[model samples]
Target chain A: MGVVVPLEDDRGRGQNAVAQLQALVAKEMQAVNEFIRERMASDVPMVPELASHLINSGGKRLRPMLTIAASRLCGYNGTDHIKLAATVEFLHTATLLHDDVVDESDMRRGAKTARMLWGNQASVLVGDFLLGRAFKLMVETKSLRALEIIADAASVIAEGEVMQLAAAKDTGTTEDAYLRVIQAKTAALFAAATEIGAVISEKNGSEAAALESYGRNLGIAFQLVDDALDYGGRAASLGKNVGDDFREGKITLPVVLAFRRGNAEERAFWERTLQQGDRQEGDLEHAVDLMNKHAALEDTILRARHYGAIANDALAIFPDSPYRQALTDLVDFCINRNH
Target chain B: MGVVVPLEDDRGRGQNAVAQLQALVAKEMQAVNEFIRERMASDVPMVPELASHLINSGGKRLRPMLTIAASRLCGYNGTDHIKLAATVEFLHTATLLHDDVVDESDMRRGAKTARMLWGNQASVLVGDFLLGRAFKLMVETKSLRALEIIADAASVIAEGEVMQLAAAKDTGTTEDAYLRVIQAKTAALFAAATEIGAVISEKNGSEAAALESYGRNLGIAFQLVDDALDYGGRAASLGKNVGDDFREGKITLPVVLAFRRGNAEERAFWERTLQQGDRQEGDLEHAVDLMNKHAALEDTILRARHYGAIANDALAIFPDSPYRQALTDLVDFCINRNH
Candidate 1:
């Protein structure tokens, strides 16, 4: 019922929290992986060709693992969680494919995006195929609550992406709006992923709500760290160029904070670089300088830690067990990791 | 049914089959339309802008009308059909938005496509939003059978699109493969639309399967006639440019039939114009001439009539009623109408 390990004490465990969860759910994770492989296949050659390009790409399977882990934590032993895990993974993969097309992103998971390899049309269609498959998987579970949660998440996530598009490159975007975007776009799925685990396990309302809270906070922290990493983290682990978000003129937490705190001259710089998308050589470096000048990245990480603490506390209701402990550690990993 | 007044004698009614069904389901259709308007209205500005551009752009509401009519045909009087109808329309609209992007089409139903006005990214994202909304609607129905049918159709439709892409610009595409493409892409939704009507009514398996067969055959016939019309019908009625399929090198039934029956010189023309996509100034004219020479368009319509007969026969099990008669006449209208 208290903080298992303080957020400041994470340096003591150098072990990768995601890897730890993966090992704990290795059996269920393998089944989910196999299910994904089997379901993604189709008679249409381009479907698998375009879909597998993204599916086989190096995703961490973090969301699916969370689904499996939450169900196990609820003390339910059944095969429905496997289908739910695969369902969430399919939903995640589908959104990524559509996202690449929306952002015109050429790279993801250290590889050429499906939109790059195939055209935007293929990415959109194949992403739809994956989504359709996700719904099919959910229907097979015959748990109406699970279906409702996932379906609502799908709508919220799409709405969030649209909101992000509206907010993109606008220096006037507020921290609150950015949080809304990340919550809807990123955390909704995470919330659904873990929430469905409890729902399928027939857990009580309070426990289900706790898991949902745990996932939502963890997802927010996860996205905050990712946004922060775009400017400050190591480029290799990210599998993307540093300042990619800056170049894309994405208005994330660091940029929003920096813009809010800047003087007139710095404000003009942001307006010219981000709002106008007129980037030149060293513009990224200059933007990074501004973020440092305002301590934006550091503050963003601190904000993420606040959410991470909430996520840790949400799991406190569950009894001490390997699954609960793994989930608890996952929150710390979400806040601390660069990629 | 005795061929339902023969496909050639549909002029006797002087009433549009779609109009008859629309009048029959006016109350439910009004609810479905209002639901579409309300659901399509999202807080996201671009979501509605892109969605309404297609939704309100003069669609006949034929699919949803079918849903309402089929439910009425089963003598059940509940409001779930309104939701299911909306679900089918949302699915149809979502696919159309994506199809326009995939086809790079600039105009549809005599209007500029959403992709043409707002960019492919908007179309893709908004289409995803609509699809998410469709799944939400289906989940709200709380009918697992309906969800399973629609979800499966979504996958089949997407797979059909991928297959159509593979078949595009290929003169070697056979008639059987072409049928598979249309059956999957077009007929699957039609089948799901009508079948769900029977399903939510608690119709027995045989009755449900009969409705499915009627819809599937009607949809196939509907698409076949449209494909043939692209070659033989007047361009003004089509709301699209004549020879669109020819220009796109879509290997539909007409093109497949022409390819199968052409002499060596004509075959060379198809290979150069279709397979190589190297069309000249008069190529469309020449293509029509070849189709006329082989009577390919006529044969395509004849094939459509053949399916229409099967569709009519499929409804013989139902008692004589206005809904049954309208559906039977719909088969003839599907084959005989140019647009």
Candidate 2:
């Protein structure tokens, strides 16, 4: 089952809002766990080992939660939501495995990555196994629209990765290019997670469109917050070491904004520390200072909040329910969560 | 389109025996190529570039040819064979892209590997792209049986790679384990390629069994020849430099054979050069001499010939036709061809 954090009384009025969402998330998460375990069960040895390593690695399961929340919001009561939820989770896990290999990363979620422990060979092959398993799950849903949307999203995810690789460490990358990559790599799956629920349940055009928009905005907000955390948040808060983006020469939104608005000296700092791939011990601290001075980090936070607001607005079409409220809370949490 | 090689001419066979098989192989190859190009057309930018690079990179297209040949021999005339052929090629290319990353090799088929040219990131992602594309192609066939077969094969392939990694440089690996690894890594796709045709076309149970056996035997033979070529063949003949497997620490059939049969001193040589991971000048030559003296390469070649004969025997169920004869020629080619 999915994990849902319950709100404590000390949180005040927000406690009621959080409690309402927690109960729905808890019930849906139970179903999701059953679905994932049943689907992941295999006679093959490597399949179970590699897949379970990722599936049990304690991802927030945000994508699946989105699917469950969307399905509940549409007044649907069927087990297909579980399948759709697992499908989204599997897709996310597959990407993580591949991403770790691409980045040659040693750590993920403060633990050694699959590539680190099992080697890139196993990580890549298992990533592939998970992908095939995802498709097998989607095919079982038997909704042509679900298949088309998910498959198209997968293609976009791969294309986005290629685009990112091409654009890595390049100062010329535009905000538009960054937006396209984020939408493809992150939001495409999110859109599918919510949209597939409406699609499988045969929701009307307007309802499906609204759910998709909510998923897209929430995904954008989540990724922007993640980018910000890389530069500004603590390891305790982010569950990852800061400055990983700069080390990997990843030109994220905060850095892009800083480079755009910073003065000449600040531009030299940005070029040497981030773009030129030379960083001193205090480079991360200096970069953070520059980002604050240029208001780049603030600008990025505002953009994330904007998307979060847009996510909340998209749910206005759905009738008032605890599940719908939880969905809205999730958008807020994307910006507010430390890890 | 698939490459067409004259079979009987190399064997100095009678003209009557060669004409039918060559014509059938040519016709089937044309269909397979058309299917591949048609399926690979995509709106994704890097996808077309990456896909075409692998598809057009002068692979012998042997696996798809085997599929088409097997289907025709089983009296299948439907167009689904083309899709099956393309599916097999896509699966094969996906493995190659992944294998290059795993092996850390920079060249394939006498040209720079996709990983080398585009970097491991592109290679890994594009490999995923081809894999997803393969599934999409299979789903269009609307055959659940086809889907199940391909899915099972993909899982086995992943397991096989893991098994190899686990067993690499471990002298404890037996001939049986070696066979299992090759079966999972190589024969599963070959078996699927042939069996899917019979299942999709609704062939008789006995015919299906025969085709499956033919594919399995031919696949084993193909791999055996490849292993032998890695040890003994010249770069010009194999399209790759010699001693590649040894460099990767892969203990193939010949090495296993030599390790088992060699005396104490020869076994010590194996351990020092391969297992100990220290190779001085002429180490490869010395290993080759040891393998030759132990008759390991000859034994491997004999085993390959044995499987090739079995592949030929599996064709007894089919009526004598040009297609059947071409399938038979492929058995000979697998064992005898240098490349």
Candidate 3:
């Protein structure tokens, strides 16, 4: 969430675009928030307690907002958008819970993970409970097309996660393979979120295709920036540890690039630290220096900027509404945000 | 799935009901098995490997068979029953994967658990993949009512698990609470599986209600018997440890009954072993002795028999077809199963 918000526009205008995006969909987001709270409730106290801890913890609510903004941009005027928004948020949260358990990470979004606070058992089960709630919420929308899109996205996301796990410490992974991983893991749901928004609004023309493209590109850009930040950004600002991927020996785009460009000795270092899990005190610092020397982090951001540009262009067909403008600026915010 | 299938019927003149059930649905089960294998495929190697480890590792496919048998009972001639059957099995397998992870169980059904073999992370993500596939299968049926039934059941099951987790190690759990947990965790899916068969067949008359009743009662009986066997059944036969719940301090119907009926000193013993986790060397034997003294295991079986009777009577409205007879005997098989 704490994305870069320029005080002045690129043209030196008065106000920022993120503020405008929230301004246009602010009331709808309130409704979405209320629906989320209502659905998080359960007769079991731990269900609600664990749900609230991670949910109410400071997520940017970016995906739900995408759903909300996309629906409004498509001229949707029904209460179902609130449910869909909540559905997107719930699905995202469910994945986060499972991801923490999978990664064995203690913190997420600057708060203690449900896995850390409650234990792995509660984290796994509660994640499942939330997913079930998400499905029920999706069914309530009565949009089978929407259901198909999100469900397929979910399946693809899981497949991507499986791929990432297999490629976790292999320096030999190609850039194309890493791209496929992020595309499926990060971008599929974003595309589904926006596509479902248009589907629910009954807009199946280029409008739906356009929103899908926008979401897909934006998601890719967001993940690339996240990869860079994990290497180069501050923990307090990013709300996650710097070099978290490095610490986990996780293979991301930056790692892929650094490994490919390194010499024989550097390659040995990479293998020892990542593949063999033999890290010394200064390995993180040395790894960052190698990335910097190879311009891996910068190139990753450059790749993200390319996607962010594509995301902005995808929305050009829509008239200059505040919603469209904010979405375009949101893409820029995702690319330029240090966090 | 190594259920206590009898060698002969009550009349001692025929094959076991489980065998009969298999004979009736053998062709359809072959197709369901094919579909499950096809869906478990992924570009990622570990997805299928982990899926096969738990899924094909000797589960009896009870829930899926329930769907097939129930649909056949309703005289449905469509191919969707196959999909529904696979859907139930996928959901069941998904839950099993997650359950093994949550319980930190090293084994399941006499084989190594996916978590134990592939690690908890793979188990968790692959479980999510299977769940996504299950939903996709449900949606493909184009029966929104069927989707709604199964989705709701899944939510209830998760809620049940959360309830159980909270109630774990608390011998003070009431019988009503225990019933709720078992109903949610186990019965909900069983009811949903059978009810969806009726729903997809468009048999919404007394037939659907009867199937629902049958499934619910049968599920309760099955779970109660499982609880009894966990303490009393042999490891080789049961395919699980004898004192799993006891070691975990889990509160089941037997534990609830024994704790409520024990004298002051015996209650203290129960508290020390179950609540305080101060298990001694002979704790398992001592626990069984106390349960035997209070007739806890017998009463639990008696309760199971009551539900089993209800299950059989629920199918009486249907004509005395071979499917109906097989289902009735299957209920008996569940209640009387030693493992």
- Candidate whose DockQ is highest: 3
Please report, in order, the local distance difference test score of every candidate based on alpha carbons: 0.85, 0.77, 0.86
Question: Worst ten-residue run, lDDT, model 2 chain B?
Answer: B1-10
Best by lDDT: 3
Docking class of 2: acceptable
In terms of TM-score, which candidate is strongest? 1
Off by over 4 Å in 2: A1-22, A25-28, A38-47, A74-78, A204-207, A233-240, B1-22, B25-28, B31-35, B38-46, B73-80, B202-209, B233-240, B313-315
TM-score of 1: 0.94
| Local accuracy of candidate 1 as per-residue lDDT tens digits, B1-339 | 011122346644524776787678898889998998888877788889889989999888889988888888998798989999999999999999999989888889878899899888778888888888898888888999999999999999988988888778788898889999999999999999999999999995877888999999999999998887787542212233567787777888988988889999999999999889899998888888888788887888889888888878988898999999889877866776655
Instruction: Select the stronger candidate by lDDT from 1 and 3.
Output: 3
Encode model 2's per-residue lDDT on B1-339: one tens digit a residue. 121222434444323333445566687779789888887775556667877888899877878877777777767778888888898899889888998998899777778888877788988987777776787777777766676677778777877787787787786589989988898889888888888878777884987788888988889888987888888631212223777888777889989998999889888888887787787888787888877777787788789889888988988878888777777877776676655
Candidate 3 Cα outliers beyond 4 Å, as residue runs: A1-15, A233-240, B1-15, B233-241
- CA deviation > 4 Å runs, candidate 1: A1-9, A12-14, A234-240, B1-8, B12-15, B234-240
State every prediction's TM-score relative to the real structure.
0.94, 0.88, 0.94
True contacts kept of each: 0.66, 0.41, 0.70
Pairs of residues clashing in candidate 1:
none
Q: Candidate 2 on A236-316: residue-level lDDT in tens?
A: 122237778878879999888988887888888878875788888877777877776777766786789899899889889
